[model samples]
Target chain A: MADIPIRIGIIGCADIARKVSRAIQLAPNATLSAVASRSIDKAANFAKANGFPPEAKIYGSYESLLDDPDIDAVYLPLPTSLHHKWAVLTAQKKKHLLMEKPLALNVAQFDEILKACEENGVQIMDGTMWVHHPRTYKMKEFLNDKERFGLLKSVNSCFTFFADPDFLKNDIRVKPDLDALGALGDAGWYGIRSVLWAADYEMPKTVTAMQGPVLNEAGVILACGASLYWEDGKVATFHCSFLSNLTMNLTAIGTFGTLHLTDFIIPYQEHEASYTTSSKPQFNELVTGWVPIPSEHTVTVNLPQEACMVREFASLVENIKKNGAQPDKKWPTISRKTQLVLDAVKASIEKGFEAVEIVS
Target chain B: MADIPIRIGIIGCADIARKVSRAIQLAPNATLSAVASRSIDKAANFAKANGFPPEAKIYGSYESLLDDPDIDAVYLPLPTSLHHKWAVLTAQKKKHLLMEKPLALNVAQFDEILKACEENGVQIMDGTMWVHHPRTYKMKEFLNDKERFGLLKSVNSCFTFFADPDFLKNDIRVKPDLDALGALGDAGWYGIRSVLWAADYEMPKTVTAMQGPVLNEAGVILACGASLYWEDGKVATFHCSFLSNLTMNLTAIGTFGTLHLTDFIIPYQEHEASYTTSSKPQFNELVTGWVPIPSEHTVTVNLPQEACMVREFASLVENIKKNGAQPDKKWPTISRKTQLVLDAVKASIEKGFEAVEIVS
Candidate 1:
């Protein structure tokens, strides 16, 4: 809280890690004190490129990086297959952890990480940076004003993109070690998490899912859809696809009206949204003089120079320093619940879209 | 095929009958030959007001109207409680039948109606007017063009409105004879039928549904939702609400892009629709940038005066005149399939959103 920079270690020198590394240096109370990767050259290159301080340690392996006492926290940008292992190990080392989008391949693995964090008295957070973004928080604020939209009725979200064949060879997105987690986990997770968060983390009472299996590759699910329901009759429908051209859209419908976000997954320099009432009654009655319901709004956000990941990690470190881990304690529960929903999606796919209930 | 007029009898003086009567006058080859209601005065008043020939028979009851041999076809706009009764009776009377939607309360009733029409050599059709609209046909055109939108992914539809308390008092929509058929039969039928029609009548392999029970009315379901799955991994979702204020919107998403129609039930005269590819490299990127991908298009259609009933009756009459009966029809088969889906929706609601498979 007093502007003391929190020491941080980088677990991988991937593209995302570089961006986060730069962000750490820019944050007021955070320092990127170390770098690690499977390749020594890659780690040393990243440390030199970022101008790591003299005290900054360079390690050839993630385990050795976590062993550094000077590194107060860890940022895990490992491949999808390695997230759970390193996340649990980082927690066991008593280092606060921030792992990428999906916390694990399945609910069981996520629970293990949660248990590790609990036993070690360390914090674990899924690096869902979008949730920490102000625009998403703004959308949540708009949803809370019942007078504006009435009872939330439904949410529909889509996140899709085409994957390059070359990138597909060794990419964790196409690898089987991740265990049935691909588009739904990589791209679809943002859409799913947005819906769940918009609904105040209320677990869907029922879920039905369908996925297109990859014909060219074995054990690859390319496109997936799921419909989740709440006890109060609210429904959320989501679609994630890796074989399609790029697209990201989210729509929330309520009894009174509907709201749409043109780009949900990516942080747009200028984001656009629209809201329309159910009836368009006045427009109908004034047919001769009718003007289209001006239903769109575009907002420009001045994002901080820091990467969303670095900002979130720095925030967590500051929270730990101020409140001694209480602020970072709620994330494991959220991450575990998300993994459970993902597991339900997989079960539904395996059983021919049989409706699966999230047991909480 | 010639310009020969078909004589039609109206078997009810309800609001729907008024609309149909007007459509018949506007149709080049359809004649309003008779009018009927529970009260002779009401029948006579409707005939006179609608400019039916002075000699046109005015029957006090539907039975008498069906007995009129001069009436080549009968349009039935009775409540859901009466649809099966009148449909079967019309078929038994050897009259081509046009029945309003939900076809019947359940699959068994629909089967009975189909059997009755088969035995009597009569044509039967559900008055599902939405599919008959030119806009719907245009939507189908867009869907069939693979280069434009690619594979169908999902269909979302909503049909909801605030009903006058007076209309809800004794109306079959609010209080159907069979307790199982509530809003799921009334407005929900349209939403379900839309999905079925859009999906090319490929009955979902499985369906899961949930409904909100009417607070003051026992055995009445108000709001309902259902998630449907197709064998090819396509998903469809439908939502209907009775207590909510008026609103209707439908959207269909595909692999390449999305098609959005604001008012699913009754679109405004100036209604426009647009298609946009998600911000990735769309398969049709070259084509999209050249023309702005046509965000929206306004289609001109003279909303058929009595849209559903008129279309159904005209189609049945044409079929009967061509083949001496309502030719063992494709329309009837489609209607039967929709009824089965609707029945599954009801079953799922009754079982607390349990999955229901659509048996052939």
Candidate 2:
């Protein structure tokens, strides 16, 4: 059965929106319905420059797009400070919401956004695209295998990128009033999400910030890390930065096996992704080397990860529109948990790097 | 120079000694001269099992091996409690010393042992075989390359192995009177050493132990970790455990590059080793993947890493013997710094996981 493509409208024309606009067009079930910015010409220019379809409407402001009856879903790529305000508006407008990460500056704001979506009966999901990659599903198979990966033990997820002086001075991410959480909310969202994804969304018992966290003049974290400990003895750590060379590394170790990849958050190529797994790895006699070497596993990327995210969101919206099913709780639940841990990390850092207990 | 092989004697026929005995024999400038244990039969069997030369002597006690005037050096793989005693005795006997790690239970005892070696003018080195591997040198090349690696930023080293119940109860490592430090001394040694090696032997200003460290009923650490903070903003972390599957992972990130290896303490195959390097890696236009994928570098292992350690130790001994040169200070200096950091970690744990400062 061929379902009608869900009409998608861009709520803000951030640089990331260009990629998401492309993803919207690439997603078979998603249609690029509208583009919106504070300036009508800027929105039209963005649409033309990003290859938005000719029929895609260009609105002078986000308020105009929100009021459009033709739009079924809104993709919000505004600064994190604006997420609470716009996400609630999108939900209240009866439009499904697919928003950029760091869903809000804090968990309370995130819960308020989720509450709006629930009351309006609208699907809500954070735009953490990599989780939708086919490679993620393939890696999950290995993690679920008792013989190969065994019980979960630890995880290390790192996401960092070198930001030039110009970005530090002008990018909305570094502005105190825009993306106030700074690296913790921007790059660290992926690291925290990756850790939660690896742990199967089991929230940690506590988070302890690492020492020597760097801060900009406005007290925004430029680089920071935290260690998360679970009741089951599984520990995880993540480091995010805006002052280092671009790097994405993820490692998950189980009782019987280990998984490693240099670019887990994003594949080196859009068409393919790879990871290494070592099952029951042991050093050979004399401990000079390993016995059963780790094997590399590559998964074909059927579609760009962002496109997969759009397709998945649109499919969920379609199910709700056609079957009268309740909005999927999985995505919102994951987004909330990631936000909770992020809050705990910030609290720990504020408390002089003490271990902050995570009640949830 | 076609120098004669330095005669080496093994004190205590521990399991590790079996590996080192073979290394002594395999080294071009090192010969296995003797074996010693509480029982002459045990020593004889160990010598025969390790393929010691036909002329290799067997001693029923360590005292007898120490008295052997023909022996130029002693490879001590004894328990942690025995290090200070045997190392001082071996040095006093006018023989060079190659002792197993955790140089001593604490820095004070380690210094006492060092003093004995210095007074006797005997060369000393810890038997951390991985550093002698050719792969380590190759990895250092990438790290030291100004264009490729830039200045160091951070390092993380993890070494873990699953120990069966019987081993946990019966192994010398678990015994208070034997290898009392347990996993911290055994596995954590490699982790700490790797972190120090990556930092080029710069001692950290502070060490903070991670929370939830597991300790056996005997009050010995079974699993633990610590973060090291340097004065120059370079940070390092290490985790070691006896409750996880065998794993050796090391990651070093610099301003412009990153290096990753799954088996840094030991290679996956004895004949060769490989590591991944990401030099100035960046994302593609849409951030779907990396611009340049991290490349894998492999180095052939011409000699077993352990043999390389033995050869290097013997050559230093030969230099002191033939050239009448003073014993090299480099090895002992590095060993002291590693022990200092280890002591700080232990102190942090003992102080209820508080940050312990390291003075020099």
Candidate 3:
């Protein structure tokens, strides 16, 4: 006697939803129940192209998807500016919410969505797939080991991708009216989240935007960076860009060890992911080489990271629905913290790159 | 027939000298001819313990070693404060010089040493051995390839090592009267040098130090970082510390490719070094993984990087000695540029983390 799968409805035909739809199919605990696009023909085409189940419903408008009583949750991959409106409505309709990150335009918008989810007793989790990867768990274990890693000292994370000319000119990310936050919201989100994750979610004392951020004519960021400082002498810096090649790096250093990975956001292969770690490395006798070199750890993924993310989210939703339990606060709490740091970095840049003290 | 090997005398019995003495012996075109210390017994012991030639002379003072006509060049590993004094003396004595990095306390002091070398017609090179590694040349080829790497966009380099309490209290690096720049010089040197190497030695337009630099009681920096901006929208940041586990990372991103290495300062093994490069990598169709994944390149070394450095320096000295060629200006020019950026970072920190414009 297996439990019924969580029925997940995707409320937008965004490019990212295509991947998430596949993930929903791959996740054993979730099933694609519905998909919606503003136009009926587009919704039908997306459903047909993405291999939506024969029983999956196709809706011309997001409101219809939210009204579907069979749907247990909604995966919202809308642009940043639209998150608040749709996320709040999805929560009001009592559907669990799985939202693409830059969770909201700012913390305030995200707070409203959280409030809605709380009032409706619905689970909410941001769509940051990497955190759910089994490899991430192994890396966190390394970071938390007192004998190996000791106290955390610093972190440096970067996520950059070269945006082709047509995309830069027309992509919703570069349009101030649509995504608005641009590269910082789209890419810097991962960097900020990685830093916070490395620090065990301890908020930094201040965030300072690095000089020379590149912006488009519409006042949207194309490339940017920021440094964060903690009261206890820990420091981190992150850089994100749409003008550079695809490179994702996360490096965390502790008193006695270091952890590094280049493909933090996306694995190089679907079935496996790997990271490198060094603990108490020493120089060779002649000082010409490392005595004990760093070691690489690879985690075999039974399912892709995105599918793992879907399974985790759907499991939370099932707990809330089938067990009559409250919505999980952990996911929303982490999402809000990431958005808080993102806001600070943007505010610091707007205030002439001055230090912005994080209130929380 | 091969030309006579360059006879190199080392001034100062610093721990680094023991390694370089071995390098000089291993270098095909160099031979250790003498060593000097404030105490003749120390010099004699170092010469004997480091396998210096049995006929090698032992001098009680640096001045005496500089005066030895049989020595064609000198390796200077004295404290940073003494670099201005001994480096100038080595050049004035017409001995080609291989001096340790953080060439001087400031560019002004380094410029004076450069002037002395110019006037004496002696070659001078800093002991930044990694640039001489064969792997570095391979990496450069990728960076310079337009089809593979495209235009350089950013770089992030870090070098850190945990220092015991004894070193924090007694090491020359932490003493104001000795290596006054502290970790900013001793550890930050490699970070800055790596950034410069990745950027093709092009000077950045501005240097801004990151906030929250940790300083000792004597106002010596124990940890610090900076961001450098180039006029062409290229950016680079580096962090260096004496308070974290040994970690060296160099990540460079271009429009079409990325280059990364974990042990950029010292190879993990004496016989070979490796780096990773991703050229025009693409996400898989479902966005769960990468297509045409990154490739690792390994370069075998016949001798250690330090030996390679010594051989290159000795070969330059031989060219000037036997071919009547002028001393190569390339090495000093790069050393000066690196020092200039370092000075700007220090100035920026002192001025409350303001951005400091680099004149040259």
Candidate 4:
């Protein structure tokens, strides 16, 4: 007999959830079991608009969705302020969790949520879809090659998108009471994560926030940057903004090579993604040109990144539910490290841009 | 009648002089008139190897070359410590100056050179060749466009090259007694110049050197970075190194657009140079990709950028020599501003990475 797919329910109909909802439908190992919203009309409308299965339940509240024993996993896309409560509750309910990024408002809250997941033996992974892309794996291979890339020396990652007037005035990201971390939590998460990914998840010794951060009237960050320093003299800087043009760049330089890509967060196309690498390039006779130019490598994707994320999450869920396997610590560990660095940047800004030491 | 090409003498046998000597020959408005070194045989061999014209003279010492009344200008490519003495004498000889950069050991010394040029009515332009590239002008047009680029917000510039062990031990750039400024003067000059060019040559309010700069045993910097902050909330950063793979990148983000290029200091190809620009890019439906992707533009080069630099410098010299016009102040002004910022970064590093205010 064919194995049953993991039954997944999404709690909260966030705008991003619409994308995840489609990903869940596309993933072969997962099935959308239900969706929840505070209002029954919203929940029912979201399910119908997203083409949910006819049998997929529509719960009026997130608590009702978690109460359902048939739901094997919860995809939580609530505002960051609400992540701690909903994420911990989902873990306590024994559901594998696909949590939205900035995993929680702070590392302490994330630690509590992580503890709950461990106690319940549930797998938890943040919804950073790009890391699951095939292209990312290819890039990682280049970074890991000792002869090609050599020792990591520096990395610079940036992600910025100009927020329209409507978004600036009405979006939850700008409201201090809502997504209080604003641009740092929302956009900077990718930059910091990319840096960590390049450094092989080695935490930095200190974080120094750049001096001039733009903040909204309610004290929510609209733009910011920070520099990270490691014990081995490796350094990295990242900039993120909701007030500049849409640009994503990751540049990692080593003793022997450089890796560069402009569209790291989201591919310019759905089918294939590309990155450029140069290994020990030499100058021409007159130093007028490169003798061997940088090469661009493309990875063809069989499935979109989000769907791949769903497949991976569901596969882990199936292993634990059917084969009695232990939860994987790799995913949650990386998420925690990303969150810890994010917290350091925020703390450095709060402390008048002083360098904040990262103990962990 | 065709105008006479400006007769240019090279003052030192520095490795860079070989390239600049070739540039002088290639420029339509300039000619290689003579070469000078402490050893007569070295000067004669340099002139012959670089294919200097049969009529071109070879001088046993820099003083003899400066006394050559036939030479209309001098291209001084001496070490940082020698720039002040040689450049001032070249100006006193009534020859226009095309001096290699880090114009002097400090801004004060640069100011003395500038004063000598002013007193002698001789044109002065530092050897920052990339700015002479036609592609640079195109990038500037985008940055200047009010609708397309909007307000300038941030810029990041980097230039690095892997130096061989012999060079690390023997190159003048790594010797405090010779160049003193080290990588900051050699490689960092390009990064700092690119940042200033992107910012329209505006002076920053303060400069903060990054904490973990690498210095040689003789207290000469091998790698360093700094952040520049403007009063209007604009910010920029630059990193330069002598221990990393050869990589050059300049990224400038405005409110409505972004401008990026990987080979800003030296084009990957001589015949054509390219940069990428994105104006008001939008995310595709579901935010999986971008709509109306960033565009790459290429500018064909009729003459190499270094030759273009020689041509521009020669043309300025011609106007003063033939038309009896005053020397242009634009080039020296920008050069001064660049040196001022460089001085601030050096000061910040000496001050334990403290923020150093730019009084200018």
Candidate 5:
């Protein structure tokens, strides 16, 4: 218990795998021991570049990597469309898994993966890296401190970027099987995950979606608008677009005041965040002489923490070793619910941005 | 073409009636000649309070007001639940009519109103007061000028306020017959109207909506959200609430920059609006080179434009006289389309925020 390192095997040598590889090397208890890619040349190149021990095994296929006896766990950074197949196969191998955002293309697929993991007694954690970031923790802490920011009213977010044509060509994101809600699936997921996590995983009771035309492939939504209705009457609205240029913003408004955080989708370590709150209207107006809240406050967060994906995977390993279960009991449950919401979004788009409910 | 005073009659002593009364008294070519309410006492009180002529007729009902020979036009401020009934009746009297927003609660009702007006040769305009305001005109002009603000990407608006318990107690807004989406019927319409008008009435090809719980006997909607999908691939999302404190904001993000205009629901004349746009990112590096677009050379609009609404209405009337057809081909058509969108919102809410298509 003092200091135990988990031997981690990464399956898939995509751009994200490199970040996870570094995180594994950095984490005190996580050691990246092996890596696999669809191509042997790519796997060999990645392993040699990362200086994996000579004994570390490399495979051209994910299944061969999963079969390795020395690999304790596997990180799956495969294309979103392939998340389910690999996740289930990894769980069956009894290997703990770290799956990427949009755990699957649909709710049914996510449920299937969850069931497989549960049956195989393998811990699974979604690679929603932002959720594991310290800034997110600080955000929750700030939101919960009613004395700091009053009753939460609404949250609005926008995360979009114009993609290069090369990035779109033959990308799994443009594949028909994924039902990608374009920006909603690619960048919008960050905003969705942020709000769902910040709001204590309260699944929106109702959802309405509006989408623009296909900017790339048919049914590949370029822009989408969503309205989420919460049980306590809190409302959140978000916009995701691929047709527009790069822009990211997140705003949380409460009774006492409001909070605006930019670059919420990415780590604050890489990008700076700014916030402002109204001053004239007192936070605690009931307190006769309560010092008037500052009209606005702007601060940048600078922190050195493990990469998001790496941190979550390491935490899952630690949680499994200590408690024999995932750290957050609600994460998997809410994650599947998020997938259901995404399904509704796709349905809404197909039906011309019609409202679609997340049926429990 | 000689200057002629426009004689107007009031068909209901509603809250909107008061606003219209004020606007009429302030318009140069418009004069309020009569007032009507369901109750004689209310009609008499309104007529006396607003300084109507000593002989100015006070009718006990809308029908009696329409029967008055001296009245040239009628402002129908009836509840949305009853708009169709009074609108059709008033149009049948061949009186130029200005009906309150939403036009009618449903598409069929709106069609009936328009058809009745056409048959009777009466000029009818939806009482969308904000659309006729000088500030709105200025905003449109600003958007249209490429050098000022170009290539609108998205528009988001919030029109929210807590409803007065006393007012909700007696208001027809709470009645089941209203087919009201509560906050949506009450305020969300304004947000939708703004986006639609700003985009030149390009009807959204599809729409979806989510509504919060109904809290009172009047079926008051606590909160509502809607997404509109335009044919040209533009998307707009909005939120409205009546269960919480007041907050009004409108933000339009464009390719060049963003325009943030607060308190968009109320006439800008009642509030001051300041906008900041930067081509150089002033907030952070991610937002770099977003300098504020200067407004020094932009046209300034002086409001309380004495005859803004009356003038627009008169222009419509004159256009009808000249063209021997609908004033602006877009007016009635867009009004009907807007009603259809509202109906779709209602349907989405009723169906648990399910996507509802805007059938032609």
Candidate 6:
């Protein structure tokens, strides 16, 4: 790719877009070129407050932002329900897509968005920031090391936050129409993604929702969990809720090793993140305690995870723009696999907790 | 009502009994008075190696130990299949009982042992050592604090250890006629107990075994997991295995707080244990990181948890012997509840991962 920085425009001034906007500016290869909202004042205020450069465009409508030819990519932070409509539009405009997760309401919608991106020869990636963290790459190294971690056996991940009364009633996540999947699409996306990441993006053979899911009056999920089973007997379980104290924990156990991190969705700090690893752990001779204790590994972050995400996405856009290179298939493939497993879980829940096969 | 220490006799030469023997010696109110085995050589050798006092009795047969009128209680570390026979014998002998877990082959046998205890007016307790840990009590204190932790929502616990080929082939836990429950009874006991502890011993309404449980040719489970659902929408998931690296993790999340610990079964060190807790955690303004990180709380052990267990059991025996007091119902009630949940999980697995209702 040439030295030209990727011009990144963000559609939707959702609260999350504020962080991604800063991430875009911090990304060396990406520039925050514009922001769009239904109201021009809201878009203008978001640009000024989020420190968009004076020359950065402010569009009153998403279509106006998409019409901007100079924009190399679009970061869509709209509610999940709108992902299919706006993501396809953004891709149709020949712009790369970086969209927030529960990528679409379900896999069918995600497939449509994917087809649009493919047809337009545009790159697409979900706004899953943690996977871009250096720590995640380091953990992946451990997981893939046969001598260290061995074959994966099981994994568990959880992402939950206690939603206040106002959020329960008014947040887009809890509203049936806006983000209809509710906690499953919101926090559960991270949990499912974390498990898939640990399994090296392998979709499970079966996904079965755990019994006793809590649903709100509007038929939006408040709390839920599911277990995923692989054909090789590897298993994963995840819990996500909007009715618990904030927790983000991911653990993967293998034949010879285990990987654990408490802040998996978002690290406790932006500058660095830590994970614990134990290879061939054993109990003390007396069975009173651990023999060789697990060791904590910390990775330094030069660019925060979100910034790394933007830089990676923009780098892909730059590759296509300057070198006429193809977009990396890894990101979109993983996104689809995560969505597929999530869709299976949702289906299992709808089918009264029956085991739902992952056809793909 | 005399101030005499409870005289405890050790039965069987299992490896776990070595630790429990030491615990009996350490308990201030418990005297390690006797050791017995199928052979005198093993009994004498075990007694000497485990630091039995010079005057402690050594017998060739368990019946000899049971015949000793001076022995006030028996610590039985026999395998699961032997639990019914030995536990009933100990109770029939009017000796207070502290038996290793999977208290019997099943609930029916456990009830038989309990009947013997009731008839003999003897106290009985399962050897679930972690619950006696001072760290556990401190964690309970936090859980009971409604202001800090609020209502219980969900819990997840895992306990696994990588067993060598020799263990898979020869360990009593894998033998159908011995510890028939295999990993479910061995490690899964702790996982289930941990969840029950987090839920304050409230039995779940149903138990559904997770899919892809790995079993040996003899139909013994080597690895399995289950999700438990409570009447109040509370849920818990547990995984246990003999095919993964050693990992013990217990996490309980509430509406306002969370408690997490990696070494819940046994601490990394015998002298101390730690748990992490977060109360009302929130994201920072940009949602890039947490506002306040969770805090780690550590509890020092004056006596190892096993010794604490021995001390508690011996104290109950003292009340029965000296004060003529009836046995404490709390320990038996919880043990029964844990066993009931385990039974439901086992039934769920037998019924092809169906959700089995907890009759009680």
Candidate 6, residue B37: how far the Cα is off, in Å: 0.8
For residue B68, give model 1's deviation from the true position in Å: 5.2
- TM-score, each model? 0.78, 0.98, 0.99, 0.99, 0.67, 0.99
Give the 10-residue window scoring lowest on summed lDDT in candidate 2 chain B: B282-291
After superposition, candidate 4 runs with Cα above 4 Å error = none
In model 2, state the lDDT of residue B303: 85
DockQ pick, better of 2 and 3: 3
Model 2 ranges with Cα > 4 A deviation:
none
Fnat per model, in the order given? 0.16, 0.70, 0.90, 0.82, 0.13, 0.93
TM-score of chain A considered alone, across all candidate predictions: 0.89, 0.98, 0.99, 0.99, 0.87, 0.98
Q: Which clashing pairs does model 3 show?
A: none
**A176-295 in candidate 5: lDDT tens per residue?**
665355556777677677667657777887776655545564667666767677777777877777555445566666655455554465532343433444422321221111133223
Model 3 clash number: 0
Query: Could you arrange the candidates by DockQ from highest to lowest?
Result: 6, 3, 4, 2, 1, 5
Report the CAPRI category for model 3: high
RMSD of each: 5.6, 1.3, 1.2, 0.9, 7.4, 1.0
As for lDDT, the candidate ahead, 2 or 5, is: 2
Q: Per-residue error at B183 for model 6, in Å?
A: 0.6
Report the C-alpha displacement of residue B205, candidate 3, in angstroms: 0.9
Instruction: Give a tens-digit lDDT track for model 2, residues A228-330.
Output: 9999889888988888777788889888988887787778899898888988876666665677888999898778999999999999999998888999999
Candidate number 6, chain A TM-score:
0.98
**What local distance difference test score does each model get?**
0.70, 0.90, 0.94, 0.94, 0.67, 0.92
Tens-digit lDDT string for candidate 3 (A205-247): 9999988899999999999999999999999999999999999
Model 4: TM-score for chain B: 0.99
- What is candidate 5's CA lDDT for residue B299? 26
Q: List the residue pairs that clash in candidate 1.
A: A246-B280, B123-B326, B273-B296, B274-B295
lDDT of 1 by residue, B1-360 (tens): 575677889888876576567777766667888988999999999898877877789999899989988888888888776878888889899888877777888889888988988898877777766666666777777777677667777777776654557756665566746434667777788888888877878888988774343433556767777878788877777777665545555666666655666555555543333233332243231111111222565566664424434655675677667756536578888888888888888788778767788997
- True contacts reproduced, candidate 2: 0.70
